[model samples]
Target: MVKFRYFPDMKDNNIRNFCIIAHIDHGKSTLADRLLEYTGTLQAFQMKEQILDDMDLERERGITIKSHPIQILYKADHKTTYTLNLIDTPGHVDFSYEVSRSLAACEGALLLVDASQGVEAQTVSNTYLALENDLAIIPVINKVDLPGAQVESVKHQLVDLTGCEEDDIILTSAKTGKGIPELLQAIITRIPPPERDFNKAARALIFDSVFDNYRGAIPYVRVFEGRIEPGQKMKSFATRHVYEITEVGKFLFKKIPTQELKAGDVGYIVAQIKNIRDLKVGDTITTLENEAKSPLKGYKEMKPMVFSGLYPVNSDDYEELRQSIEKLQLNDASLRYEPETSEALGFGFRCGFLGLLHLEIVQERLEREFDQNLITTIPNVEYHVTDRQGNLFIVDTPSKMPDMGDIEMIEEPYVKAEIITPPEFIGNLMTLTQEKRATYVNTHYLDPSKVQLIYEIPLSEIIYDFYDKLKTVSRGYASLDYEFIGYKPSKLVKMDILINNEPVDALSLIIHQDQAYYQGRRLVQKLRSLIPRHLFEVPIQAAIGNKVIARENVKALRKNVTAKCYGGDITRKRKLLEKQKEGKKRMKQVGRVQVPQEAFLAVLQLGDEK
Candidate 1:
């Protein structure tokens, strides 16, 4: 057993630090609202649903993409007053990094499960993450008020997964405010306080942050072994940047100014630091006078898994788009973008994201928040290319692939996909995976009716429409979670789209050889429908190097003759028609076909969407 020495400046008994982890639409934010109301942190009249999810996009989508930490004062029936710091985390796998950071700052986690949905993919994913963090997990079944609750079945699942007693599971309906008081009491009595050493140097962990135009970058931190105040000077272990603290506060729905935040406390700090990049999440904070020997462990930075190009609809707004992305990146560190130019689309930025949802969120934010019309390219996974000379480099865009003569081999990313669904759907799901080149892994029965299927699949195959197909085959019951499993050598070819004999570099794609012919045919057929008729018949071709695998033609617009022909000579009318034909031929030779932006977008979804 291990023992902890309390920081001399603060006591641990009155504080409880914990976070709520759950699957998407699993009542996490709703439960947080009840906790705040039960503790009188916010009055019922002043409370809004999902108040912690401040982003408009999150509210619109009914999902939490970011984690927000808030402090509540709960007075128990035993006349014991406690300070509860609750961090609310997002449920989607795309935001797993945020969940991990939130777990790192807490002593315990509320393992919330939907009473109806029971255990989903993200539920298992987050529970394992919490276990890895060594957090004390409290199993709680939420939304018991729903008619389809299936309370007993969910309870059994929870008990079996957690290895906890049935009596330990708490049932609550966040919408109706039932069981809120008991939940508060459990948090204070069950969750342990942060451990600290009185003689050790001051240390704080920065778990999350937000950008403020007026206040700059405000970091939410958990004090591990020290106290921080408005006037204290500190240094970040990651950035090594030192600054004198300008303010210290705790978030109670909003920032509430506080005199000091000691060990076992969760609060925000304003260090007058304008640059958000300096406030790296997972970085340790120590006093400048006596810097800590090393930063906290497990501080790996998040790397983007998917990449795409974002260009302005109007080329003139390129600078505006660049500035908007810069401001957005200040708050979202996972977004990676740099300047890139395209032959077909002109200037844009190649942006990297965690997953498809992340890419959608960033694109939505850009269009809705920044009010700019934009065009996004097809998302691509990073590929590792090895040359004949044994030099390895990464290619994010298909058009950037090295020449075949110089390339030794191409390696594509693969993922270990975990899928859980009813056993009845297993047959169909297995068939779907085989079509996508999925390597079968072991399957286990979660229960009599539920099964967990594992497979190793190419990231490229799933990046586009595998999830949609899986859902269709499983009848919307299957849930998926995946992790990168490195790269393997594959027979991949670069497929380019050519319009009127000219290749559109922006429309290039990397695809497996087996599906190349079918996909290429489908792409050209879709393009032929989307591209408008030009002056001359325009040919749309999908090519692999010099070989054209699929081709379609967009018929030229017909020009009718309406000239006056005084019933005199048929020769005069023939000459007029010939002149018109010659004119059209000359125009076709001089005029270039312009492909609309939507045509490009349509090609991206050709295989995915109906």
Candidate 2:
């Protein structure tokens, strides 16, 4: 009897799996489009720009929100056929967890650098992530045909950063379809195929998964040591629960059914996983009878750093919003939420996200895809609050914080931020970060022209206008990447906003003592601009416990009650004015200010206080 690693013919033309990594607008998606076109994976008419970015928001924003994996076939020299598995990853920092998950499933990566832009923060950060996974990285310089293409400068940076030879870097213009053949040739020649172990127990790594109403949860997997197919009894390495797989397939844009997904192949398995929670993204799937003892490495649970309250615009849509969020949770594993209510906002869920952009994407997706009208509160980061007598608890929302008198100390999450930009922008970036209370760490030069600055800054600072400020100061020359290091003790307090002497808990926030006054002033100022003039003066005050830090009022729209007494006596005018004042007082006592939708959104714009 003869045994084959993947397939009998696959040994002749091996399979190569790889993904592209770059900063935003660096042309990873364009390069992917060119590859798909060149390989004839799809007909010319069937293709569009960023075809892998399936979401409507991704297409409109020109950014990839998800990591899409697909398999393509390439025929070289009119004889040898090769299987190319390409996992196109997101470029934004908020989706770095998605990038890491995709990288772990692949054996190699194409480290893409934009010719004119050179090395940015995310490019460097992803390179280190690829290195940690021991992926074979091939440096590629893209957009070489652009008018401002400085191919030589970018090549030098790549050589310096990656330490690869100058000639090893492939130059390509994904827009014009130039040097694509050479790039594909390099993939088959330079990047080696996945190693195989046929005789061992079946083991496959689940890198991503999706929920199917009819078929249940299906996991996209990379087989390490075995073959998986329909009718095979498999158990989750993490859950130890057994189920029978009904189907197995590979991605060619769509699910193409295969007889079996063997070792060294990338495909999906339908174990009929009814419970979406059981289908973990990083779990290992193996045969039930002789299962692998150890779970796959490089898998970690992602904690949501940013928290916000998502409330329905209509109180009646609360149930629909909950269902939509639950459905989205099945697709996004990192999303965490629980039932939370506010006295002013009514019923809502306090949802957690990886970052600000992640929160934005989810909110947009829910509104667009699920047809749910939601009002997302300002984003907040998780905090560690230690009360007196050594009791500790997590406060993701300001309302969750204990009384100030009972609390010993509060710790805010801190991240080690890596920022890369032109040497000239270093001073400007330092000023911007300093305003956010960033602590200087160190600096290094990728080359003489590009500088990398490291700092330890509070995660809350970056969650707001830090990115916008960084870009403004640097004039679009800077890039940022950050990771949560740990929590550190800070002089933090819960600041509440009072509208007409009533505390609106939804507008409350936890802030450092030093920034409490400044932030409060900004909040009141923004709310004052957003709220419309009322029948009476409505005071908007920002207070810390009992002390008011800032106050802004929506002035009353003066009505001319005395105008009717145009030719009347002076005493008659005075009596009319007095009666009007008494009526205004009565209205103020019983009237409730109806805050507009934009007013709730004003919390997000408070960071623009500058």
Scored by lDDT, the top model is 2
Best by TM-score: 2
| Residue 387 C-alpha lDDT in model 2 | 85
Lowest-scoring 10 consecutive residues by lDDT in candidate 2?
A: 1-10
Candidate 1, pairs of clashing residues = none
Q: How accurate locally, in lDDT, is each candidate? A: 0.85, 0.87
> Can you write out model 2's per-residue Cα lDDT over 1-610, one digit (the tens) per residue?
2122233357723899999999898999999999999999999898999999988888888898877889988988878889999988888888787788788888899999989899999999999999999999999999898899888888889988889999999999999999999999999998889987766788898877788888888888889886786778988866778899878888889887777887888988877787677877677889865577787786676678899999998989999999999989877777889988988788999998988888888888898889998888878998988888999999888898899989998999999999999999888888888889999999998888799999999998888888898889888888899988999999999999999899988889888899999889988999998888889999999999899999998999889988777695799988988988998899898989988888777767876657
lDDT for 437 (candidate 2): 90
Could you estimate the TM-score for every candidate?
0.94, 0.94
Model 2: number of backbone collisions = 0
lDDT of 1: 0.85
The clash tally of candidate 1 reads 0
The TM-score obtained by model 1 is 0.94
